[model samples]
Target chain A: MTKYVIRRLLQMIPVLIGATFLIFAMVFALPGDPTANKCGERPCPAEYVKKFEEEHNLNDPLPIQYAKYMGKLAKGDFGTSFREIPVKDELSERYVVTAKLATIAILFETVLGIFAGVLAGIRKGKFIDNLVLLSTLFVISIPIFVIGYVAQFLLGVKWRIFPVTVNANATGLDSWWQLLLPGLVLGSVSVAYVARLTRTNLVENLRADYVRTAKAKGLTTSRTIGLHALRNSLIPVVTFIGADFGALLGGAIVTEQIFNIQGVGGYIFSGIHNRDGVVVVGAVTVLILVYLLVNLLVDILYGVLDPRISHD
Target chain B: MSTISTRRGNRAEAAAAPSKYQPQDGLLLEVDDLFVEFHTDDGVAKAINGVSFDLRQGETLAILGESGSGKSVTAQAIMGILDMPPAKIPAGQVRYCGHDLLTMPEDERRKTRGPEISMIFQDALSSLNPVFPVGWQIAEMFRKHRGLNKSESLDRAVRLMERVQIPAAKERVKAYPHQFSGGMRQRIMIAMAIALDPAVLIADEPTTALDVTVQAQIMSLLEELQQEREMGLILITHDLGVVADVADKIAVMYAGRIVERADVYDIYARPGHPYTRGLLDSIPRLDQKGQTLSAIGGLPPNLTKIPAGCAFNPRCRMADHVCRTDLPPLREVEPGRESACHFAEEVLRG
Candidate 1:
């Protein structure tokens, strides 16, 4: 088992490299120039542009600049944020807010999604199956931005729950409560997609011949499902859940915009708008890393689910 | 949803169905005019129409029939494993020791199915679960029926594996069904069927899917087990050659009814029913050298649109005007040998 895990973990390097390279190329290959964005709307003075250009290594060729960026990324240097002022408390505090919500939302989504899916799949023709079918459809059909706005209207503005938008001036615990509404609105949507994927996977698992044999053994239907069916079904669900979770972690740009949460998603969105070159590329790079890591974790979970699964 | 709910319901019923067949104080199983039908889109496909039989201690009754002969249906009906909707028991009484199996409570039926009267399915590989170790699968019988603890259940599994003659029973008990060959798997199925020492065993086509060599081995194993356990064995099959040496009595099923029933020797030597006679003649026997082997002409009649006179009238060469216009009652062709044919007397006297 240990050898299997080690092999899986090591196998992630190529996947990460491939993902990082793709994201790097996409950002660079886009129409707008990163250096032009760095100069701002009014355009900098000749000397000021030159100084800024040299400071950011714009004088280097495109290939050299890309290599240096990847090199610094390797050394854990995310680079200076594109802002008029220096590193400050406001930005750091906002980053923590988004991270906390993302972590909590992930935990809630995975647990609830997998639970409902497996439960419904095993019971198959029961009420739980119908509930899962309806719930996933309901969640998947709505847009994430619409989900945020609707949640704000119903739970925030009308019901007087959490604040509709994060109070821009809030700090620490106050920020969490202010941002909690957006998290829930967004999390529910992910749950729908994940649950549906899980249900389909689990249903297939229960249909396996082994499952029928388990039932024949006169094992209670529940034990047959729990011990024999659940684990196998969870293997496929892991793939979808991992991929979806990584996408969620990549940040919902519309969700951030509507909620007034200045987290990674908003940071990236604002970076593109304000031509903050460093933040845009840096945010995307973080997402790639997260995506790669999540996939690797899923592969390990697959092995846990089915012992036959191995990297080597 | 409906299909699944019904299957779940049937599974529950099948598990419970056998408990109703359990021996109360003396008798283990009883069936009287049991009628099972298939509810198709067109109409009810009467699979087993008015079939009745008794199973006693240490006796093997080989219900012989070709495909669609209702031998398997009778066994399924007795076991209460018949899937409903597509299949239904319209009217009939299946009583196990006076506990009406058809009308028994669900939980009691579940208890009877495996504990009191278990079944060995036709396709051993398909019937046994592929994921679980064959031993655990066998042990499941002990756990469910006998209420053995986990360790005890697992241990019983190993013992059953050993008893079934699986190689390295201790270790093989941990291997999955796919690891074993066809014959070995059928033995595993046998081990499971006899797990709780059920009062009655319904081995439906147990050796049908096996090779000729494996077929004899399974038949002998069943005979040995039947002798040792003294449980009533109902061997449902089309192979007369295999059952000739094993069966105590032979019940010949044709077109959803028993056309003839007799002692194995009587059925083999002086076959009573036309269908039984045809079946006997078809076997390439060493005793009948240099004789043209007789083959039964025409296909068996479909149960849905049976002939008005005798179900077998269209296929039988002896059918006359009387045979084509009137139904033949099951009557004694000779002592203890009954044949359901209009010309059974003339055929017997010949």
Candidate 2:
């Protein structure tokens, strides 16, 4: 298992290089100059442009520039944004908030999603089943921004239940409290997907031959559904949940924007608008690393869920 | 149908005052006029129609039929594991130890499943949960029903694995179902079925999924277990060769009804029903090599639209107007033999 994990980690090196290169190329290819509008409402002077170009290695070919950037990245230097603020400091600050939001979203989706799914699966075609089906469908069809705004208006403004926007400087429990609404909004669609996936898998497993054998073994309906059927059903559901967690960690763009929470999505958003290649490439690189690690964890978990799958 | 009503009346009285029922005259199970139907999109398919049989201690009764002949349905009904909405028992009485299982409280009926009556299905691989270790699956019986602790249950599971003749029981207890070969997996299934020493063990085409040589081993193992516990064994299979040596008596089903029933030796020597005779003729004989094998004509009737009168009339050589107009009830053709045919005596004479 250790060898397998090491191999997986090594495999990520090529993927990380490819992904970062693509983002860097795209950001550089933007139809504008990075040095424009520097030193206020006008183009920089000829000497200033030359000195800036030389210092940042912008005068070199694209490949040579990328190589220089990578050399600094290897030493943990994320470089500075166009505004002269360190990209590394910006990312470090935002990542904690994003991670906490992702954690809360995952927990909310997993607990409620699985619970609703199991109930709907066992009582298929019943009232609760129909309710879950209709509600999930309703949630899935609507876009996230709409739900986020609507929730904010009703629960925060109208009902006086929560803060309309997250307090950016809040820490610990207070931060979590302020982020709760946005977190749930981010997780809403995933909850629908998880619930539906879990329902479909659970219903199928409930009809499996082994479940019949369990019934013949005198297991109560609860034990038969809970232990025998549910265990097998969760295999695919867990895979979905794991992948969704990685995506969530990348951050919800529209959600962070509406709630005004400082997160990776906002950083990437402003970087794209300003055509700041360093900020865009740096933030996305971290997202890529996080996604790869989570995928590896999911694969390892697959082995544990199903005895048939072996890591070796 | 009249006999079924009388039995239902008796069961009604029995259900009024339920109690801990005891076996009478060694009778372990009695399936009386059981009917199972599935309400599908196409129509209600009559799976089992007026099927009835009984088992006594140490007795082996083999139910023989082709696919969809309600043999497996009967077993599932007896086990109380049939999916209810699609599959419904419109009328039936499954009596275990004089207690009517069909009418008994669900909790009470469930309690009887593993300890009093257990079943082993056709495909052992699919029937066993894929993710669980073989021993843990076996140990579940002891843990849940007997309230044994984890270690005690696991110890019992190892012993059961050994009892089923699985080599290296201790080492293989942690092995998953997919790790074992087909025959060994079937043995594990058998081990689980016999774990609590059930009074009646139903083997639903148990050896049908195994090899020829392995089939014999499983059959003999089942026989030995039956004799040791004097358990009533119901072996449901379509294979005549598998049933010949192990079954004391045989029930041949056609279109969800028993077409013929007699001692295993007698039925093989002279089949009273045309369907039984056709089944016997289809079996390949070494003495008759190079000859074209004879098979029953056409196909088993679709459950939704079984032929009028005798269900076998469509394929029977002796079928006439009388065969098509009247459904023949299973009647005694000899002192100890019963056949459901208008001309049972003529078939028996031939």
Candidate 3:
């Protein structure tokens, strides 16, 4: 198992490198002048363009530019923005905010989704089961931005329950409460998917012959369903959680923008729109790394849940 | 009448009125007039209609029937494990040690389930929890029912594995169900079933999924265990050959009812019901190698709309107009045998 974990960790290096390279290549190919974009509509002198190109190595070949970026990245520098602020300094705080938001969103999604899913699975074919299934489908069909806007309107604009846009200056509890609306919007689709996946797997597990055996053993209803059926049902759910973690991080873009939260999602989104290569590629690389690590953790968790799944 | 109870031979209650309890020498488990029905979209399925049987301690009662004959359903009802809603026992009494289990509270019934009466299923592979180790599953019975601690229960689990004759049980206790072979997995199931030293152990087609040699081994192991524990054994199977040596009394089921029941010798020597006779004749014999095997005519009746009167009448060659019009309740055909057939005497005489 240790060897398996180590192997997975080592495997992440190539994946990260490949992901970064691909983003870099795409950014390199974009038909625009970074220096000119930075200069805005102000008529730039030819010397200023030359000085900007020289400093930023924009005149070099794409491969050489990529190597230079890698060199700076290896030295723990994410390169400076066109406005002269270091990308690392800009992303670090946003990264924490995004991390907290994703964490809370996923936690909410997992807890509520699993609870509803288990209920649906146990009461399969009943009214409650149908109700849960319909709601999940409804959630899945609607887009996140729409969910965000609707949530903002109902809870923020009309009810005045929460601020429509998160407070950037808030600290601790105030910050959490402010982030709640965006988190809910960001997590709505995931909750639906997780609930659906969990319901499907749990319903199947509940019907398994072993469940019958567990009942025959005189274990209480809760013990049989929670311990035996639920554990077996979690493998697929775990897989979904792992695969969706990456999506949640990347997909938080719209929700963050809607709520006006200055998180990595917003950082990356504006960077992509403004064609800020350093911020875009850096955030994407970090997100991919996080995704890879989550998947690895899920595989390890799978091994723990099912003894038959040995790492060897 | 309340009797003063004493524990550890406390003399304080010794002068109280004599205990109302008296030892009765009779059956350990009895299913009287059991009627189980399943309500489905089509209609109600009369799965087990008036099925009756009795099990004595240290004796093996085999309920034999073809697939879908409600043999397993009867066992499930006895164990109180059948899924309700689809299944409903509207009329029946499952009396265990003079206590009606069917009407008992769920908690009391649960108490009786693992510790008093346990069951092993046909497909051991699917019956055993896949994620847990075989020993841990066996130990779970001890932990939940007996309140044994983890380490002690694990020790008991190893002993049970060794008792069931699994090799290297100490080491294999950590092995998962998928790691074990089919025979070994069945052995584990048996180990779990007999863990609590239940008064009655229902083996539902326990050997059907195993090879012939392993089948014999499992039967003998059950026989040995029954002899040691003196527990009532209810072996539910469709195979006529497998139960011949192990079962003391046999109840041959057809269309969810016991068609004939007698000693193992009498069942083979003289079958009182046409269905039982047909089952015996269909068994492949060495002398009948070249001849076409005899088979019962027509399929078993649909449970939703079982044919009126005798369920076996349409399939019985000797079925008469009376057989088609009247359901023959199980009646004494011999001194110690019962048969549910209009012409049971004639069938038995031949």
Q: Best-fitting candidate, measured by TM-score?
A: 2
**After superposition, candidate 3 runs with Cα above 4 Å error:** B1-23
What value does DockQ give for candidate 1?
A: 0.17
Q: Write the per-residue lDDT of candidate 2 for residues B133-168, one digit (tens) a residue.
A: 999999999888888889988988898899889999
What are the chain A TM-scores for all the models, listed individually? Answer: 0.81, 0.98, 0.94
Question: Candidates' TM-scores?
Answer: 0.80, 0.95, 0.94
1 or 3, greater by lDDT: 3
Listed per model in order, the count of residue pairs whose N, CA or C atoms clash below 3 Å is 9, 0, 0
* Steric clash pairs (candidate 1): A213-B129, B15-B110, B16-B109, B16-B110, B17-B109, B18-B112, B18-B113, B19-B112, B19-B113
lDDT of 1 by residue, B220-322 (tens): 9999877776677899999899898999999888888888989999877788887888887788978899999989999987777777888888888888888
Lowest-sum lDDT 10-residue window in model 3 chain B? B1-10
Fnat for each predicted structure, in order: 0.14, 0.90, 0.86
Ranking by TM-score: 2, 3, 1
Off by over 4 Å in 2: A29-31, B1-22
Q: Write the per-residue lDDT of candidate 1 for residues A1-312, one digit (tens) a residue.
A: 678767766877777666666666666556664545455586556787777777767778667777887788777676776565322333455557667667666776788888888878766768989988887888888878777888888888899877877776787788767766777776787777667777887788666645544544445557667877776666666676667667777776777888777777777787667666566677676666677777777777665554444456
Say which docking band candidate 2 falls in. Answer: high
User: lDDT tens string, model 2, A1-312?
Assistant: 999999999999999999998888877766777788777988789999898888778878888888899899889999999899999999999999999999989998999999999999999999999999999999999999899999999999999798999888897899999989999999999999999999999999999999999999999999999999999999999999999999989978999999999999999999888888889999999999999999999999999999999888
